[model samples]
Target chain A: MDLATSGGEPERFGPTIGTLGEDALVSGVIDRYPSAPWLTVGPGDDAAVLDLTGSLAGPLIACTDTIVEGQDFLRHWSTARDIGIKVAAQNFADVAAMGGRPHTLLVSLTTPADVPAGWANSLADGLAAECSRAGAVVAGGDVSSGAEIAVTGTALGTLAVPRAVLRSGARPGDLIAVTPGSGRSAAGWALLRAGLRDVEDPVLAALVREHRAPVPPYPAGVEAALAGASAMIDTSDGLVRDALRVARASGAVLDLDPDALRPSADLLRAASVLGSAAGSEPEPDPRDWVLTGGEDHALLACFPPSAVVPAAFGVIGRVRSGEPGVWLGGRPFTGEGGWRHWS
Target chain B: MDLATSGGEPERFGPTIGTLGEDALVSGVIDRYPSAPWLTVGPGDDAAVLDLTGSLAGPLIACTDTIVEGQDFLRHWSTARDIGIKVAAQNFADVAAMGGRPHTLLVSLTTPADVPAGWANSLADGLAAECSRAGAVVAGGDVSSGAEIAVTGTALGTLAVPRAVLRSGARPGDLIAVTPGSGRSAAGWALLRAGLRDVEDPVLAALVREHRAPVPPYPAGVEAALAGASAMIDTSDGLVRDALRVARASGAVLDLDPDALRPSADLLRAASVLGSAAGSEPEPDPRDWVLTGGEDHALLACFPPSAVVPAAFGVIGRVRSGEPGVWLGGRPFTGEGGWRHWS
Candidate 1:
C-alpha cells in the first residue's frame, strides 16, 4: 500500500502494508500519520526539527525511548499495535515529564526477514495510529534485518513557553497531587501472574490494558506545567519511587494522606480471587500496590495549596523541606514501589 | 569520567554510564560531544538542526539500523563497545551511501540491567569515539531494560553544494566504478565461525574488523555527488547485488567489466590458503567471494564517461539502457550476494 500511488501497481498480497523497501515502509507509515506544523522536515530528511516549546522560550526539551521485544514488552500479551502506541507513548511521556508537549518523532526497526511484512507495517500502523492520537508526526526512520524485533524512537518536543516544572521545582509548602488512582498495573500484574482463568471483571480487564500500554495523561502534563506545578513526575517506577526522584531532586519532605488515597486501593477487587484462594486476602493493600506498581504512568505533581488543582487530580499529600525520601506514614515506603534493575 | 571533568565523582564504578536519568544522559553526552556553530539547540531540545552549507543544498538523507543479540553479533567475539561503534557506523554509512556527509546522530539502546556497568559505558564510549571519527555527534537516545541488547540509531547528514547521487539516478552509458572489494565480511565470518583463531595477515585482521565495525568512506559519498556521478550505492551487500539495486531503481542495465575489477581479486589470497586445504580453490569461483561478499560496505557509483572519477573510485563497468538487471561479461550475473535475513 503505497500512499503515494499504490506501491508500484500493488500485486495482490491483500493490500500490502508496504513494498519491501525501507523507504517505502517509511512513506507508507508517514502517509498515515498526520504532519505537525512544528516539523520543519518530515520523514524524508536526515532529521526533523520541532519549534522549541521549552519552558524558556528558546530551548527545546528532547527525549528518546526505545522498546525491545521480550525486554520492554512481551509478544504474548501485546499486539504489534500496542507496541506502536506504547513506544510513542513512552517517549512522549518523557517529554511530558519535562513539561513539554511532544512534537515530532523518528522511528527505526530491526527485524528478521522471515518476519511477516504486516508485523512491521503494523508496527508502523501502530506508530502512526498513536502519533495521530497524540498530535505528532513520524519524521524519519531506518529499517534493517536483524534477529529479534526491536523498535526505537527519538522524540522532539517544544515547551511553547519554557517554564519547565522540573523535578527540582518542588518546595516545602507544595501540595502533592496524583492525577489518578494507581496500583492498576500492579493489580493487573497479579491477575496475569495468577493466570486467572475465566476472569470477568471489567476493571480487571482495564487494569490489564493499562499494564500492556500505559496511556499517559498528556493533557495533564501540559496543564500541570502551565498551572504552576512546582515539580512533576511520571509514575513509571512505583509511585513512591518515581515521586521520591522528584522529592530527592527537590530536597523536600513528602507526606502522604492515607485517608485521601483510599480510592487508589482497588487492587483487591482484581486480586480478590487470588487473595481468596490463598485464604488470607493475600494481604492486598491497594495502597501498597498504588505506591509500588510500576507502569501506571500517572502524572504526579506538587503544587501550592492555593493553586487551582484540576478536578481529575487526586490530592495525595503535602511537602515540607526536610531529608530526601518518600513516606507512607512517618516511615519510608519500601520494596516493590521502587524499581529494581536487577536486584 | 567526563572528558570535560573526568575524576571528581564519589564512588568508582566502571564509567559514569547509566548513572544519569534520561535528561542528564543527553546533557552528559552533549557535555562531551558539543555541536558546531550551525547547531541550534544541540542536545537539550526535541531535535537538532545544522545550517546547509550552500545554496545548491543537497537533499537531507536519513537511515536507521538496529542490532540485537543472538542475531547480529556474537557477544563473545565482540564487546559491547565494539557493537556500539559498529551500530553507529552501519547507520551513518547509509547517509554516506546517499552521497551526503553525516552530520548528526540519534541513538537508542535497549539494554539489560545485568549487563555490567563497564559494558554499558563502553558502549557509550564507543559511540562517542566512533561519532568523533565520523565527525558526527550522538545527539540523543532512549534507554530501557530488555531481555536482549538492541541498539538503533538514526543518522542525519548534510549535502554540500552538490545534489545527492541516488541509486535511482543511474542512466545508461554511465561507467560503473566500485571504490573497493567485497568478500571481507564473508571471509571474516568464516574465520569466526570456524574458530580458526586469528590469522596473521593484517589485511585479514582488517577484514574481520570490517565485519565487526565498518567505516564507510564518508568523503567518497560527498565526492560522488560533487563529481557528477549518475548513481551511487553503498556496498553493504556484495558488488553485483548492490549494482542490481541501482539497476532496478534507475531502470538501466548495469554492466560489469570483470577485467576492470581484477584489483578486487586480491582479497582471495587468504581464502585460497584455507580453500586449498578444503580442496580445489573453493566452489564455482573464489572471485565470487570478493565480487559477491556483502558487508564490505564499499561505495559503488556509476559515473558518466566524461565525469571526473577519482583514483579512490575503482572503475569496474558502465551502465547501458538495456535489460533492467546487472550483467558481468555480457551475461546476467546470477550471483545473489545480496543479504537475506534468513539465508
Candidate 2:
C-alpha cells in the first residue's frame, strides 16, 4: 500500500476504544487532519462550518460511499490505515468524476468495542493523508459501536465549470479515453484471493499493494472538464461495465480498440502464474484484466473529436450512434461485468 | 411514534434485498424522496449536485451521525421506517444547533443480506418524511452489505444569519432556555425497557412512541440564531449533560431553576410504573429523567439578557460568571452523564 511516511510509525500499543471513552478517542484523533482555511468551526462542536461563498457559483457536488469489513476488505489483507485510505479514495473519485474540486469530507466509522483505540488514530492518519492529497479536509464525523468495522465517507465538492460532466452528455463522434492506471487492483485481488500475498515477483507484490489502495488520477478529471469533455465517469466498476453505463445513458455505442489498450506485459505474466496455480485451466488473458477489472478508479470520459484531450489520458475508443452498448474490436463485447453488492 | 400516514403503509411483503441486488434495491427506493429545487443532479449519478449559490452567502454547516441496531434501537421496538426518521432527526438537529437551516442530507446504509428488499423502501419513506419536516432533501446516498444494519447521515446546511451560533459564544448574563420537548424520549426509553409496550396508560404509551421517534423543534434553532442568540446546542444527551457542554465551552456557570424545568408529569407516572415492575422499594425520581435522560433532541440555547428570545422557548435557567459547570437549584448538579459510544 502507498502509506504515509512523514508522521513516523503510529504508536499502536494503547488502550482499546472500549476503555477510552468516545470523547477522548475523538479528541485524540481529530487533530490528525489539517484544517482548511474555509473551516470556521470544526470538531469539538455540534457541527463544522465552512465558508464557500464566492468560491463556488453553481451546483455543489455531494456523494457518500461506505466500506464494510469482510465484504469490502479483510483484516488479513489490510490494516486499519489501509482501509481508511481506500474508503477516502473511492469517495473522492466520485466528486472528481463530476468535474468538481473536492472541498470537505465527513467520515463516520463504526466498529466493535474490541477494536484498539489506536486503530482510530491510524485510520484518521490515513484519511487525513488521502484528503490532503485530494485538496480536501476531514470536517466532521461520527463514531458508534457495531458488529464489525464500517467506514462511511460523504464527500462534498464545488464545480470548476458551469455544468457538471454527466454520463448522458456523450454524443456520436466523441473520442472515448481514460486516464492512466487501470486494472491493477483486480489483478491484486486475484492474487490475494489465491493466497499469494507474499508473491516472490516484485512486480506482482506491487500489484498486491495496489489492490489494497488504488490511486485515481484526480486532476485529469477537472482538466478534461475544462477542455470541453462531454461525458465522464470513474472506472470503479470494470471498463466494459462502466463504458456500458455511458453508452446506455447517452444512447450511443462505445466502440473500443484493442490495439490502443496497450495491455501491460507484467499483468500477462501474473495471469500465467494465476492460471498455473489453479491447475489444468486455460491461461487467463491480461487483456481481460485491462477490459473487465474493477476498482482502478481511472477516469473514463468522452470528448468531441476536435476537443484537446489531456496529455495524461490515453485514447481508447470512439462513440458511435448504434445500439446502446460497449463494443470491443468491432464485435459485441459480452462478458462478466464488474462488482455489485450482494450478487 | 409520529409515523407518516400520508403515504400508504410500505409494502413489506416483497423480495429480500439479497435476491433483488443493490442496483435494483437503490432504484426502487430512490424515488421515495421528494426532489428539492436546489438539487440540480440527484441520485443515479456519480454524485449529487446542489445549487446553493446565491441563497446561502455565508458559512455552510455540516455534521454526521450514525445509528446502529441493538445499540441505538431494537427491531422489536422500531421498524425500518422509525430507524430512518430517528437517524435523520438526530443529524439535522446538529445543523439546527449551529443556527443553520438544513438543506441536504447524504445518507449511507450498511445492511446484512437477509434484510428485506422492501425494508430499504420503507427506510427511504421514513427518511423522506423527516427530511420534508426539516425542509431538507435526501440528496444522495450509498448502500452496502455488512453484518448488521447501520445508517449514517451527513447533514449540510446554510446559516440563517451572517454568523453561526457556536457553543463558546454564550455570555455570563445570558438566559438559558429550551424549546418544547425534553425528557419525553427518556421516559419512553424507560417504559420500553420495563416491558411496558402495551401499557394501558395513554400518556406512558405516548412516551414509548416518543422514544422510538423524536420530533425536534428544528425551526426554533434558526429563529434563535436570527434573534441574536449567543450560543446553542441540541439536547441529544440529557439536559444536564448538554448544559454542562455549553457551560464548559463558554467557561461560564449555568444555574438552572428546577421549578422552571416543569418536569413532565407523564414521566413521573412512568417512573412509578418502572419502579413497581423492577420490585424496587423506592420509586425512581422522574426529575432524574428530566435531568439525565437523553435523545429528546430539544434545542438548548443561551440568549443575551436584552435579546428577544423566541416565544416557543421556555426560560429554564440563567448563566453566571463562576466555575465552568452546570448547577441545579443553586447547587452543583453532579449526576450521571449522558450517552457515550463505548461506555
Candidate 3:
C-alpha cells in the first residue's frame, strides 16, 4: 500500500513532473494501450481509426467528461490512475445508460509542473484498461501543460440496433425499475473525508473501492435493453436526482415506494462511519443518500409492468402522468441533493 | 469592431455573468452548437449519435487535443473565446490529416474561478462558429473548475472510402509536393511578439490569424486522397519536421527543390518580416523558416512525378531512397528545431 520507494527520498521518476515532455507521456500511454483489429491505424498516425465492419447505420452516441484535481478528484485520496479510470467509467456509463456499447475514447490532459510522472503514465494505463473493459479502445489523445492537473475523456459508442431507448421515451404504465441501489460511494466519500482508515469491514472496503474505481453495470444495461425496457438511465447522480433527469427528459411523473428499497438499501459499516462524520450537523437521512448520492453508476430503467426484471435489479417506482417530478409514497420527494463538480 | 456601447464603460449584457450558472454555460454551449445532419441524436440525450449511413467498413478516425494557458496559448494576445476556437481548430486539423471528413467534435473544458461568467459562453460561441467552419458539430462535453484555463477537444471523422492514408505509405518513386508552405504561424508568432499592429498587412494579419486559428486544409486532403497521393501529412510541427515523420514512417527519404517554393519565396512581406526577426541570430536561411518553423497547417503530399500537381499547389520536393531524412536542393535539410510541448 505504500508507494514510497525503499530509498530514503521519494522515488524521483523522469522529468520530476509533466516535464519529461507531453509526447513522452502520450507515446508511453499509447504504448501501453496497444491496438487491435478495430483499430485500422493507431497512434503516430494523423488520427486513430476504427473499422466499422459490423454496423453502418449504427447510432453513434458520444459522451465526454473531465476530471480536475482538487475538484473532481483529490490527489491525496485518488491517484491519477484512478482519475483516468473514473473519467472513462463515468462517461461510458452515460453510453451504457442509453443501451449503447462504447467503441472508442479520446482523452486530453493538462498538468502542472509539480504533478508526478507516474500520474500521467498510470492514468493512461487506467484509461486503456477501462476502455478494454468496456469493449472499447483508448483511441487517441493529447497532452499539454497547465497550472493544475486535468484529465478529459470523450467516449464514442454505437447502438448496434436502431433503438436508442432515450431519456424521452418513458411513459405512464411503465414500471420504474433499477439495476441496483445506491449510497455506497457516498458512504465511502464520507469515510474518506473523515480521515478514517483500517475500517476492517470487507463490504465497506468494497464500497470504498467502488467509489474510487466504479465498475459500471455495462452489460446489464444492454441486458435491460434486450429485456424490453422502455427507457433507461444510469444513476450517476443518485436515484432521485438521476431519476429526475429521466422524468424531465421523458416528460413523465415518476412515483417511487420508499419501503420498496429495503433490500437494495446500502447498510454497510462505512455508512455508520460516514454518518458519525456528519459532526452533530443533524445528518441527512441515509435513504436520501441512496435516493440522491451519485457516482455508483447503476442503471435505472422503465419497463412495462409484465416485463422481466433481472435478478440484480429491482422495481421501486412507476411512471405516471402528472407534473414532471418524482414522488415518494404518492408525496413529493422533498429533498434535492446530488453530486456537482467544483462545489 | 467595438464590443463596447457608446458609453465609456463596457455595455452590460442580459443574464449578467453572475446570473448564469455552470449548467447554464453547458446548456448554452450545447444550444449554440446544433447537431449536424449526420448526428442522429445530439447532446442532451444519454449520448450523441452520428447516423452513419455510409459503408459498413468505413473508418472512424478520432483525435483529441488540449490547449492550456501560458503553454499552448497566451491570453495576452488571444481571448478565452479565441482560445476556444484554437482548441477546436487544432483537433480538427488531426482529422484533416487523416484524410477523413470531419463530422463531429466533443469538447471538455476546465477554467479558473476568477474568470468572468461570460468567459465560457464566449468560448462556446467561438467553438460553435469554428465547428461550423469545419463542417462538424459539438456532440457533447464536460466542465469542471480548476486553477488555470484548459480546453480539450476530441474530434471524430469518417473516411469516405474504407481505407485510410497513413504516414507509412510513401515510396522512393513518389514526387514530393506541398500544397503550400506552413511557417506562417511561426512568422506571426514573431510578429505578435514584436507587437506588430499593421492590420492592413494582409499577409501579416493572415499569418496572425493563421497562428491563432490555423485553418486546416480539410478539402485538399480529400482531394489528395482521391488524387492518388502516395503519402500525406499536415505540416504541423514545421514542413521538414513533419516530413521527417513521414520519412521515418514510410522508410523513404524526401528531397525538396528550392525553386519549387516560388509561391512562398515570392512573399514580399513575409521575407521582410523574417529578415527583421533573424537580427544577428545568424541570418539563417529562409528555407529553415519554411522548413522548420511550424503552425502553418499546410498540406504536404507525395505522388508520382507524372501525377498532376493541382494549380492550388506545386511540386516542392521529391522522394528518394537515401538515409531516412529530408533534402533541400540535393543536400540534407539540417534544420533541427521543432515546437515541443513541455521540454
Residues A1-343, candidate 3: write the lDDT tens digits.
2453111222235555546665566666678785766777877677888876665236777888887877777766665566778989988988888778887777777776666676677787778879889888877777777777788888877775567777888889898888764777776676666665335567666666677778887887777777778888878778888788788888888899887765233454455556666463444356756877788888898997778876667888889988898998888889878875544
Best by TM-score: 2
| TM-score of the B chain in each candidate versus the native B chain | 0.84, 0.93, 0.87
Q: Which portions of model 2 miss their true places by more than 4 Å?
A: A1-8, A54-57, A198-202, A273-284, B1-11, B198-201, B275-283
List where candidate 3 sits over 4 angstroms from the true fold.
A4-12, A15-19, A55-57, A197-199, A262-268, A275-285, B1-19, B54-57, B79-81, B261-288
Report lDDT (Cα) of residue A110, candidate 2. 94
Candidates, DockQ: 0.23, 0.83, 0.63
Q: What shift in Å separates residue A100 of candidate 3 from its native position after superposition?
A: 0.8
| Per-residue alpha-carbon lDDT of candidate 1 for residues B1-343, written as tens digits (9 for 90 to 100) | 2321222222235533344444444445456555665454455432343343443134445566677777677766666666777888877777777667776677777765555555555677777778888888776665666666778877766555345666778887888887764667767766656554355667766766667777677788778777888877787767787788789879998989888765344356656556655534442345666677777778888888899997779888888888799888788888666564444
Please give, for residues B23-115, the per-residue lDDT of candidate 3 as tens digits.
666676677676666777777766777776644226778888888888777756665566777877777777877777877888877776556
* RMSD in order of candidates: 7.0, 2.9, 3.8
Global lDDT for candidate 3? 0.73
lDDT of 1 at A159: 60
Which candidate order results from sorting by TM-score in descending order? Answer: 2, 3, 1
Docking class of 1: acceptable
Over A1-343, each residue of candidate 1 has an lDDT whose tens digit, in order, gives 2322122322223433223655455556566566765544455433342332223234345556676676567655566666788888877777776667776677877765555555666677778877776677787776666556778877656564456667778898888998775878777766766665225677777776677667888778778877778888777767887878788778877887777666443466765656775534454666677777777778889988789876658888989777987877666666554554433
